[model samples]
Structures are given as C-alpha cells and as structure tokens.
Target: MKLFYIKAALLNTMLLSFVDDGTILAQSKQLDDNNVGLYTYNPSLDLGYALHTGTSPLKPKTYWRYLGFYFDHRLTFHEHVRYYATKAFTTVQAIGASSIDCVVPIATYGYCLWYFNGARNKGAMNQLKWMQRKAALWIMGAFRTSPTGSLEALAGLIPVHLMLKKLATRAVYHVATLSDTHPLRSMMGEGLLKRAEPHARSAALMTPAMLGKVKSTVMEVDEHIHTLTESFKPFAPEARPGDRLLDRYADRLHFDKRNPPQDRHPYLDELIANARADPLTALAATNGSVPQSNQYQAASAAIIYKGHRELERTHYVSGRVTAPDAELNAITCAVHLAVKQANCQHIMVFTDSMGLAHKAVDPSVHSGQAFSLSVCRALQEWFEADDLRCITFIYVPSALRWDIHGEAHKYVTKLKVRVGRCKMDNSIDALRSQAAHSVLDSWSSTFQDPTYRGSEFLELQWPDGRPIQPSYLNGGPWLSTFRHSITEFTRVCQCITGHAPIGAYYHRFKINKPHSCTCGAAFQSHQHILFCCCDRYSVHYPHFLRDIALFMKYNPKAFGFNRDPSGVGSLLRVGLFLLLEDLSVN
Candidate 1:
C-alpha cells in the first residue's frame, strides 16, 4: 500500500511538470490511457490522437477550454455554452439558496433551460432578445413588492447584446490601431478583413440575413462604423483621392476628414465673390435683422446684389429706431437701400438667422401681429416699385454660412464692445438661467442628504448643467466584462435615496409582512443588505463586498468615490448594484 501511494504521487508530480512544459501529448501517449480525450465537432476528420509522440493513440473529446475561450471541434459553441450555463446555474443556486425559495422564478428557470435547448441555435439578435426577455422577467420577480408604476419608471437596463457590442467595438478599435505588419494581422489574413468588409458598406446594402451573420467583435465594429457613417453622410463629403487608403478600417473612417475641395459647396463661390468685391458691404448684406426691438438704441442693415462677374455693389444702412419692432425696422431699411443703391434687378438676400429669414419672406406666418403688419407692407411696396424684380431668401446651414455670418458676428461684437451701448433685448440669457436651475433641482433630488459634499459627482454634469444620470455611466472597465440589468442600477439609485421597495419601504405600504430582516435587524435597509445581513454574510454578502473593493480599485472616479472618504456610502451602493447585476444570469 505504501509503494502504491508513492507511485501515484510520483505520477501526479510528473503530469504537472508535463503540463507546464506543454508536453501533455507526450505524457498521454506514454501512458496509453484510453480515458485521454480530444473533443471535436467534425467526426469525419480523423485527427489521430498522438501524431508527434511515438506511442498508442488517445481518445477524442467533444469539448474543451483553450486559452480562456471555450471551443469544440465542430466549431459550434453549443457544448461550450451548455458547460458555462450549468456552472452559472449551480453558482446562483448555491449563493441564493436562503433568499429564493425552492420554487425558482419561471423566468430564471426558463433562462437556464434555454442554455441547454435553444440558445446556441438562435442568431445573435434573437439570442439577445431571449436574454432581454429573461432579464425583464427576472427583474419583475426580484422586485415583486414594488408598484408596477415604480418598476416601469426605471429606465430599461442596458441589454447584454449592447454590452457585447460595446466590447466588440472597442476590440475592433484596438485591432485597427495595430500596425500593418503586426503578427495578429498576418495570422488573421483575409478572413478577418472579409468578415469586417460587409459592415463598411451603406445600410441599404446591409440586408437582414447579412446582418444576422455578424457575430464576431470585428463584424460588430464594422456595423457601428457603417451606421455612424450613414448618419453623418449629409454633413460629411463623399470619398476623395487618398481618402480610401486612409479608411482601411472602420476606426480610420471615423477620423478621416474630406479633402478641402469636397467641403466647398457651389453656393460658396457666389458668397466668396460677393465678399471679395467689398468686405464691408458683403457683411452688411448677409446680416440678419436683430431679434429685439424695444431696447435697441441703434440699428444697421446691409444688402448685396450679384452680377455677371463680381457683386454689383453693397448697400449699408445705419439709423436710430424709435419703433418697438426692431426686426421689422431692419428688414425695411435693408430692402429700401438695395432697391436704391444696387444695380441688379434680381436681388439675393442672405441672412445668418433662420428666424430673420422666415420673417423676411413671410412675416405673417412666424412674426408677431404688429411686426408682421409693418414688414409685409414694406416688402409689398418695394416689389410694386420694381426696386427688385425677384428676391430670393436662401437659408444657409450654420456650418455653410460660417464665412458670411461669422464675419458679421465679429463686426457686431466689436461695435458693442467699443460703443458701450446696450444693443437689444436678448431673452437667451434668461432661458439659459432657467435651464440651469432645472438641472440643479433634478440633481438635488437624487441625494437623500442634500449636503453631501462630493465634487466628483458634480464633475460628471453635462455642459448644460444637468447631472449625467447613473443609467448613462456603464461601469467603465471594471463593469465592462459584467453586463448589468436595468433593475440593478435602478436599485442602486433607490438605495441611495432610501426609496427602494426593500423592508421598511415595502412594509410601510403594507406590501410586505415585516420591516425587520430574518437576522432580527430592526429594519432591512440598504445598509443591512451591504453590511448587516447575517444570512448573506457567509457567501453572498462577502462576495459582494469583495467585488465592491475590486471595483473601487479598478475605477474610483466612475462612481464618484475617488479621493473622497465621504463617498464611501455612494461607492457601496453602486457596488451592491453591480454585484447583483453580475450575479444575475442574463
């Protein structure tokens, strides 16, 4: 018996060494063990168990893990998925035994069954839809005590498909950044490029069947790029010489700007000619009527006429306005000047402001009754007098109108600075102030204690002053591998605000039988879940805390916990939220 134990120990040691040295094949061949397996999907192809090692053959396996990725010889992920699904189900059952009754939620059970039955058979989108449905049902069961309206209030959680898409997009970007001579590129060859190429085409060409086949990260990256390009096509110019080479991949295409010639529109030629003839006149002619009337001390108007080669002439008019309607006054002034000073019969009036343009053409439609009456009369008088045979109001987009409008804006800004005179009644400042207050009120409501001094949260505010909602903060790198469900993040928010459908909150509404936990805690609050729950301490609670520490270590600022000891509560709340999501089976 002693000799047999020693021999077994020696064999185990030798096997470990062989595995470390990547010589498992040699050891397996020497043993001639029929139990040695080679997993594969293709039964027709005979990959002899031990080719290099001179010994008896080893048996084949149907599935195995290689370099962190699950694989099967048949190239189908069915077996691989089933293995993981079983492991996950077991883990969930072990940890949640105390909380969930023997009868598992139908949704959770169905999700487990899917891994063995239909999950592998479906396409990516269909698979994602199945997971999403399961997720929604799981959330409903988890927060069963919450009101239906309250549950509905929570924004739909980021789906597993989207998380995968984001990761895949990032992976594509990483690959695209690699040098042309990188080893991975050579190994991938045309297979990688061919798979990604379909995503580079226009959306019209990307058929549903073709889209369904896009399962890999590379393909997802391509699809995102294609979608973005299509959205920006109107703003972005068509491809030019050398541009195609620059856009070898989706990432490259995102940053590739059109050549100078392509960005210049044909209308720009007329505007440029008009400007070059007389810079001052062109600036005045293109300027829009001021929006305000009552407070204006001085007003200015300009007009430009296009001729065969250059601008015929520019007309600039400046005067004081006693009238309350400044916009109407400016338009009347410009038209009278154009008819008197310009040579051309057909006149073109270019304006930077869309409001002014609308009022100039049809004042009765968009302007106030008082302003409309005056502006319409003036325009009709000019046309009847033959001051202008034809007048066209061309509305140039802001980017396209930069040269004309920008110059006018600069001139006006300088004049206002030098004269120290109040220009007009501008309501933009009042509107901006109102918007800022609204954002502040919304943010304040999120924190139970309004005095919580954490500048980190403030840093996440949008340019318009509205706080970036927690839903938008997809847990950076730490949470990247773990996709969260909608209810999970919402729970975090509820925890922080003390509004969750947990013990006391539900008990108060008569939804639950008791406010106290099984551990005899006075109230089963968010704090109890994180720190005081005795039932969860052994497995669920400890694991959750460890995940929180890991998350803080990975990205402290993402959850507004960085460099602030006071933010510990916020950090734990977010951590618990993430842990619940990580544990939940999609």
Candidate 2:
C-alpha cells in the first residue's frame, strides 16, 4: 500500500511537472489568425494529442525502482540507493524548476535553427551551449551527491517532470476534447497516430536562440500588453459610467459619469450595433439554420457591424479530432504549408506528443532520431526583422475541455488507432496524408480543402474582387510584412501638430516657418532644426519617423526625402526619451 501511494503520487505529480506557476506567459495580440489551418487553440484540436501524453500515470518509474520496490520496497541497501537517486533527482529538478522554463527545450531547439544563417556564422551559440551544458552538468552533479551510486537510474527523471509541468497546465485538458465525435479517434488519438508522418520533425533540432526567447518571455507578460485595455476602452460600450465595472478598476480605468475618454464609445453599444447588421434572423435566411453545435464565431455581431476589418490576434483556437495523427501532423503540416512559402511571417508550433511527431517526421525515435526545429526557427528569424516581429508557440490544455464548447462536457476522448486492415487496407502513408488535410472552410488560405473542386470566377474579377493574398506576397518574409504594416497608420496622432494629414503640407508650415527658431534661440534653418526642437515641439517628429519607417518598408513612395520641423499641440512628460538628457528645461 505504501508503494502504491508512492507510485500514485509520482503519477499525478509527474503530469503536473510541466506546469509553470511562477508567472503567466501570454502571447501578443498579433497571433489571432483564423486563417487556413484548423491551426489554433480550439478545444477539439487536442483529442489526438491527449491520448498520447494525457495518459494518466504519465511518468513511469525506472525499471530498477520497480524491481527493487517489488522485492523489498524500502530501507534496504537497494532501496536506500533508489532513495538516494530519488533525492538527488528531486534536488536537481528543484533547481531546474526554479530557474528553467519547460517549453524552453523545444523553443530553443527551433530558435537555434532559425538564426543559423544558412549554417554559416555562430552568434551567442557557444555561450548558450555552454550554459546548456553546464545545466546538464548541474543535473548530473546531483548523482555525485547521491551516497549510493545505485541512485544513478533516477538521473534524468526529475528534470523530465519539472519540464513537463512547466510546459502544460490543467487548462490543457479542456483543449483535448474539442472534436469528440470525429471519425479519426481510433488511429488518430492514440497507439499509432504519429506513426504515418515519416517526416514530421520536432522543433528542437532547428533553432536554439528562438527557444531562449521563448524561455525568457514565458515567464512574464510584455509591457505593451499591460496597456492593452487602456488603449481599447474607447470602443467598448457594454457598461455605463455609474454602473460598476469601471468602479472596480477605478485606478486602472479612467472613465466616470461625465468624463469618459473623449473619443471612446461603449463596447455594449458597439456590439448591439454590430448585431443589427447580422441579426440571427439574417444568418438563418442565408445559410438555413445555423448550427448551435459550433461554438466558434467570427467577431461578435456588434463589432462586425462597425464595418471595420478588426481582428483579434491573440485568442484561443480549438477544434475536435478523433482521427489518428490529427493533432500533430495536421497542424504541423498546415504550419509547414503556410510558412514554407512565406504566406505569413513567423509561426511557433508546440506539442505534448512525447517525441511522437519527432519520430514520425524522421523515424528517429528509438532509432536515434532527434528533433529538428528548422521550420520554427526560420519563422522566428523572419519575425525578428524590423518589418516583422516574433511568433510565439504555446502548449495549452487538450483535455478538461468542458469550459470550451458551450455544452459543458467534461470527458476528453483519447482513443488510439487500431493498426489493422480496413476496407481498402490503405498504407499508413496514405492515412497520415489524409489526416493532414486542412480543416479550413472556403475562406481558408493555406491548408487546401480535400473537398476542393475549384470554383469558377464570374468574370475573373468582380467589382469586389475575391479576397486573395497577392501571389508575390506569399514568398515574402512574414515578420517583415507584419512589422511594416502593424503600426503603419495605426498610431493615434502627431505628438506635436496633432495633425492627421491633409492636402499638401499644412499652410501653417509655409507661412509660419519662423525667421528665427520657434524657441527664439537660433535661426529657423538646419541649426534650429537640430538644437532647438523642444519636448513640446519635438515629440511628434520621432513618432513620425517611426510611422514613416513602417510605411517606407511597404510603400517606398511614402518615404519622403525632406525632413520638416513642426511642433504643435504636444507636451513632454518628465522622462521623454527622445529629448536628449540635457534638454530638459525643467
């Protein structure tokens, strides 16, 4: 009974090993793409994956421990040695637990490959490798502390648990059950799902630098995200001033009965208006009755009614799958297809597959196949450009999907594939390929539909042309493309003039170009342009420069040759970085 309790504790605690509790790491809002693949964080996407690693009693005891426990279970020489091993492992893992990130191994692997620069030059790699090697030694050193070398068998087990829990959380369970009724359950969910993908590579062998970033960022939220709600309150109309939600966040939120932000509208009102445009009645009229079973929807009716192309970038994507390999190969294939040609910027892919996909893609499992994170690293490098940013990969819950679909179902289906003859006795190759079919609807871009028969254009170009990514753009780097476009015209305004562009330069510039500098110090030519630009007058120029750079990357026409000096309608805060430290008149 004591042995059973120990094993049981190891089982339950082992799975929790990967959970990161120190700080909640969240991705940027830029990742909410509901494009071609079923590639997202849907509750159903985890079904096939869940069966593989979501198994209860996730970690196994060492072979020696099993035998030792079976023979005598405790306090004997053999038992003490095992105890020593366990204690050493626990100490090593505890250090790793406090200092390491669970998702790091995969992230680093993929990241290193991305920056390999055609395998030509080496950057911080030697140092990073040294750190990793030392970390490995740190782990190995635990054994020296073990009085009996008999504890050696437990050498690596604790690190495994520490990493796993730091990676996945209880929330992952909900993601595991999205597609409970899908047909792929048998072969897709367990036993042999990743068996077919003979080339599915893991993210480790590809990039190491990228992985390091994931490790660092996985521990904390970004500063930009801290201000997200403050920047968006203008569009939300759900609550009234005196009513309450605003009161709770009185410090963080700045609205009141009479003093709402000048340009903001309520979210509830916007939703109501958007709802009007696509009343439930209208959707029923066009598409028969809408399926209540589907929980996913585009932006809410109210927001959609606003007639804007606003999209939520960071959101939970999910789907249900029962097919073998549907969880791993399908999403990975979609990422490959989407990014191989540069359809989007960068993409990060994560899995709890326990080397299943790693082995499938390379047949390296057991045969000494290692993870190759090349694809993911390439994506990261592409995102690092001034034009494109970074793409983060996250591993989420694939079971306990109860909170996902509105149905509130608790059980996640984790069936395994039965390798047997079917009606056609298709090869695993064919089955895996079929499993990788894109889950996109007609609107999808990357994952091609298995049911596609090709649609005819009315005249090849309608008045409103069919939305298609320009074929040329597909080959461009996604990170650069997104970076140049994201902040292009999105920022609020000129920090000085408060101008939102008009016909030609404002006449105020032509007439008001002062004979002497506005600061009354120097002549208003190049000298004034450099020395006298004050915080009150100089703030907007930097913002203009930033926006201009974004624009120039995409539309070179916007990169004007001339620089102008105009400072109006702005004040510098105490710590404006653009102002030289000496310029603060205060």
Q: How do the residues 366-478 of candidate 2 rate in per-residue lDDT, one tens digit apiece?
A: 11111123223333344334244232222222332211111111111211123333222222222222222321121133212222211111011112333221121222121
Candidate 1 per-residue C-alpha lDDT over 1-586 given as tens digits, one digit per residue, 9 for 90 to 100: 4553454344322222134454332123433331232211112324443422324354446655554345555555654444444443454345532222221232122232223212353543444444333433344333333322222223223333333333333343344434344444442324334323323343325567865653443344454332111011111111233322222222211111224336445655675576456422322244422324323333443444333333332323233322223334444455555555444344445454445645443322221223334434444554556532444444444356455444443443233212236332322222233334443344335432333312111222323334444231333221232233333444443443345555766666677467776667888765566555666434345556666665556545544432333555645544654343242323
Model 1 ranges with Cα > 4 A deviation: 1-266, 270-333, 365-371, 397-401, 417-460, 463-496, 501-586
Model-by-model lDDT, in order?
0.39, 0.26
Q: What are the RMSDs of all candidates, in order?
A: 22.6, 30.8
Backbone clash count for every predicted candidate, in the order shown? 11, 86
Candidate 2 lDDT for residue 183: 33
Off by over 4 Å in 2: 1-437, 442-466, 469-480, 484-486, 489-549, 552-586
Q: What would you estimate as the lDDT of candidate 1?
A: 0.39
TM-scores for every predicted model: 0.32, 0.16
